[model samples]
Target: MAALRKAIQELKQLKEQCVEEQGVEMAALRETNQELQQQKQRCVEEKDKELAALLKENKTLKQEKQRCVEEKDAKTAALQKTNQELKQQKDRCAEEKAVKIAALRERNQELTQLKEHCVKEEAKMAALQTKNQELKQQKSRCVEEKDAEMAALLKENQTLKQEKERCVVEEVKVDKKEDVEVKVEPEVRHDVKMNALEIEQKLLRGNIEELNMKYGKLLKIHEKDKAEMAALRKTNQHLKQLKEPCVEEKDAEMAALQKTNQELKQEKLRFLEVKHFEIVVLHERNHELQQQKERCVEEKDAEIVASHERNQELEQQKERCVEEKDAEIVALHERNQELEQQKERCVEEKDAEIVALHERNQELEQQKERCVEEKDAEIVASHERNQELEQQKERCVEEKDAEIVALHERNQELEQQKERCVEEKDAEIVALHERNQELEQQKERCVEEKDAEIVALHERNLELEQQKERCVEEKDAEIVALHERNQELEQQKERCVEEKDAEIVALHERNQELEQQKERCVEEKDAEIAALLKKQLKKPPKALCVVKEELVEVKVELEVEQEVRVDQPEQTNEPIPTTQRRTTPRWRRVINSFYCIRPNVNDD
Candidate 1:
């Protein structure tokens, strides 16, 4: 019994020791649990702080991202605007090239017309020169013949003048003889011839009256003839003077015509030079256009590369965000598991020490509530950041619209410049025509003056002939000279007329040639226009392909973003235990309202 009692006492001691060890174990577990709870609380607080910091950082990142996105969108818009401007500039350049081609064609036509005009003018001038030479020979022959005729007439006039002087001397002797006869007769007829004498006296008085009337008539006739001869000589001299002036003017006009022709040739040369310049400019422009096309193609390739790289970057960022979200969700799941394990351990420990365990659980729950509130605040900040990004996108679109407007204005200015250039060309053509007409009028005036001079020379020849009757040798010589001069003038006039006819023929031929040249130029212009149109037809398809590719990239990016958002809820884990975390009636109602309202917002 003593041994059994000793064994029982040892057993009781061992049992008490086991109970003490169990208490120590429980105390240790409680201490560990308390430490774990504190650690969980600290972790929760740290997590909350980290989450708050993350939320704040995310808000800042979102704001920065919004700003970056706005800037990127602005850059994209600017690029698009630049692209649009480039396309417009290309189109304008193409139009300008077409216009230039048209202008060149017109210029070629004008040059051809000018060339034909020059050819006709040269032909006319040659014909005029031939006619002038022919007429000059005729005029020289006529002058020589007239000079011979004048010499003969002057000799005859000198003989007649000498005869008239001799007749005057003979008349004086007759008057003396008649006086002697009258004295002898008067003595014989003293008585018988007294009546006869009265009759004779009456006859003498009648004879005297008749002689006086005849003398007056002769004097008037001679004076009239002298005046007519003087007038004719003056007219002839005036005509000769006029003829000389006409010849001088004709020479001047010929020189002027030559100058004008030279000017026309210069104009043709200038036009040719301009055409060459235009061709060079066109070649340069074509090369530039080709370069521009290459640049556009390169830019398109770069844009495509950039788009692809951006897509890659966006995909990487999305993947990273998704992974981070997944990691966060996994962490939440691990935390929930840890919380469940702690709760299980606490429940088991609480069965042994219920009062202290309940108080500790209450403290843990209060800490959890504070962490959850902080998390909610962080979520609200993320939502606000998303709204800011959307506003930035809208602003970017507005900027793009503004850029488009600016490009349109620039295009309008280019069109106005084109119109002004056309107007200036028209004015230049008008001025050239006016100048040509003025030159023609001056030529007509010169011809009229020459004709007037010829008429005056004819009158001068008559005056010299009449004057030759009074003065013998001197008058005859002067008449001969005047007649020869008149003949020379007449010949000169005929020569000039022939020259003018030839000149007119040359002008007509030149005009016809000009017309042919114009036609050729027109044909060339038409060909150029056709070429430009054909080139324009080739450009549209390439631009469309580029635009289509950009649209496809945008579509793909949108779809990926949509998919990421759609998978967000399903991929996330439940962090709170449903049994332990009962939904507040107010929160449940608010959640229900939020779901209904959110769908309505989505629909709107």
Candidate 2:
């Protein structure tokens, strides 16, 4: 740029020197007529030579201007291409950022879903824990109830053993009383009474045999019930044992899931942090790009202003050249006028020389006119080149402005997207909170139901205990009444021996009626025992079948749960409501135990 400026200054100086030299030559021509003609010839030759040199300079100047304009056009074209490429890159970057942002949004949504799943799993775990605690309590209660029942059974066994010993002693006493009664009988009636006594003894023996058979059957039924109970206990224990390991495994899996969740949370945090950093970097980059654009625009504006100054300078130079041409022409015309007057003064003596000089002058004037026309055309061409450069610069500026506007719009869209994402997250959080509250409510209701069921079981146990005590009292009263009757009969027999002959017929009638009553009572007891035995036989199999079915269902459910776990490793299905359902089997076992024990005690 400095070299070009220096060249323009030199050209200006040369043009000024040419103009001064032309003026000096014309002034000398005006001073002397004889010298004027020869000086005019010299001046004309020098002016022609100067005009040729000026034309060469103008051509060189035009060539330099053309080269400068071409270089500027090439630079502008290359800058525009670069700007186009940058805009494309910016557009691509914006598209990529949007795509990446959408992908991140999807990832965030997936993470939120995972988090919600984790929360639900945690809720399930909590429910399971509560269920497990309830089951443990139920197991403990069952065990305690079993222990109490066993103890009661043992006590009943001891009482039965004592009752058996008492009954054996009473039977021996009764045999002694019978011997005394037999010995005291009147001799006249001894044979007939012996026959009757023998018949009665035979009948009593048959009744005893039937009672023994029934007792044995009842014992067998009781043993079977015991065996069934033991089996149920074993199965219950087995189920619990299996559950323990499975529960442990579930706990371990839950822990692993929690760890994975934590890792995911950390990863999400890191990703968010990274994304935030990237956004910050992008903002910084945008700011830097803006600054760079501002600098480029300033530079372009400066370049345009410089181009305008160059155009003005070019116009001034063209005007100066035109003024210089006109001055030279005026000087030539004045010289011609002087020459014409001189020609007239020396007419007849040198007419040919004068005419030849006029012809030469005309040719020189034609050459000057040709040179001026060429220069004007060249000036016009340079002006057009400047205009083109200015237009190209304006286009580059407009394109840059459009890119900036597009960038701004893209940024606004991104910000709106961010706001929407935040709002969605807030809504999701609110939904999760509501879900958690619902789970809490469910848990509380479950606990209340369990407590209520426990109270009902306690009341049932108390009722059973009361019934057992009432049955014991009734059996004791009957035994006492039977013993009193036996003593009264012995007293009456002693009196009958003393008052014999008169009361003999009445006593025989009373004895026959008592024997008939004994037979009827034995038949009724046998019928009642048979009915009880049948009932006991009917009940246990149904209970056992139900228990077995329940166990099978539990095992099936466990398998299903395991399959669900395997299929969806990242998610968990809700556990079954076993807290309530599991109690059924335990209560069934309790009822079965009660049933098994009740019949034996009642039979005694």
Candidate 3:
């Protein structure tokens, strides 16, 4: 720029010098013109032949002077134009120089700022480096601490595991000891008692195993939760790296961070894999426990049967003992009867013994009546106890039914969450499809702008590409998620249906049980009614026998009175028995144990 400015100044000086030289040349030409005019005047004065030649020469000289002036003017105008262009070029150059200077100054400022920034950055980097080093040291220390803690925790876990195992073993041993003790008591009994003992042992074993499996599952879940937390931290770090750029450094740092992120993602995947394995293990344990529970239930059922048999045996033994006692009482009664017969023969001459025996019989009948009343009270109490037991069983069934309803509700919530997930997936797929359509439209417009003749073709190609991408993305996504959702809903529906089926089965079972209970109650009522009818029949026959006895006693009294009247006929002629007949008793009293009725005997 300075060079150009100096060049322009030199050119301007040269132009000024040329103008001065042209002015001097023009002054000399003017002087020559005046001398020529004077020469012309002289030529006229001379009036000779040299005068025409002088005039021709003078005119030619005048033409040459005009040509010189025109040439000078053309050169001056050319110079002026050149000067203008140069001035413009100089101005442009000056502007360019100013721009360059500004740029240079800016660059210098930038360089200085950059240098300062570099220093600051260097300090920052040093600080960061120190921090990084500190972080590295801290990380190392953290790693060391974590490793130590992990080792310690692992050792503690191992010790806890060992203790758990020992506890499990001790529990098993104690369970076995309890089982043995339970067995020993039953072994002494040897029949149903042993069965009961074995059932209890099996139940205990099943419960123990179930508890152990649950504990193991809980432990595994705890471990999985810890692992999941670690994995989440790793994933969080990875995601942070992916989302944020390393603005402090270049692309290399970006690449490194990406690599680290990939590593972290891989680690997360590994953790997921471990979790899956743990889940599988837990499932297996659950399956084993379920099987154990099933076996225990079966054993319990067998024990119930055994207990029922033992109860029957005990009842039979009680009945046998009662029968034996009854037989002894009967034999004692026969011995008392023989003594009574001997006493009767001895008392044939003394009537007082007979009266005493009659009174004793009346006391014995009263005692029998008291015993029958006590038996009836016992029977009524047994019936009440049975009713209470039935009510309790019904309440238990109702509770189980409520639990089933809750389970069904939970299942419905799970189904709804699954549906929501499916819908979200579908929405995501639809958004992707819309994006694909938009991309295709953009592509079609781009193609249309490029080539009109091939616009349709380009559009078609774009459409096809978009369609293909959508097809692949949407079809795969839609098929997988839709199919999965469909399958899930199907499975859920099936599960719901299965649960309904189970509920139906339970309902059916309950209905069947209720039907059976109703049948039993009906049978019991029928039996009770039959017993009441039998007692009614027996009471009527006894009442008829008592009526017949009363009638016979009245008939005997009439006959004895008639014979006495016959023997005293002459002494009491005035009261001589008239043949007037007395009317028969009109009403008979019926005693029916729980009810008494009077029957009119007018027809009789």
TM-score of each: 0.25, 0.29, 0.18
lDDT of 3: 0.54
- Model 2: per-residue lDDT, tens digit, 339-360? 5565455544443344354335
Q: State the weakest 10-residue window (summed lDDT) of model 2.
A: 565-574
List, residue by residue over 357-418, the lDDT tens digit for candidate 3.
Answer: 43353363355346436534643553464355446534644554464455446446544654
Model 1 C-alpha lDDT per residue in residues 161-236, reported as the tens digit of each score: 6755775675566557657677566455455445654675576567556656755765675576557557645744
TM-score, predicted candidate 1 vs. hidden true structure = 0.25
Weakest ten-residue segment in model 1 by summed lDDT = 593-602
Model 2 bad stretches (over 4 Å): 1-32, 183-604
Ordered by lDDT, highest first, the candidates read 2, 1, 3
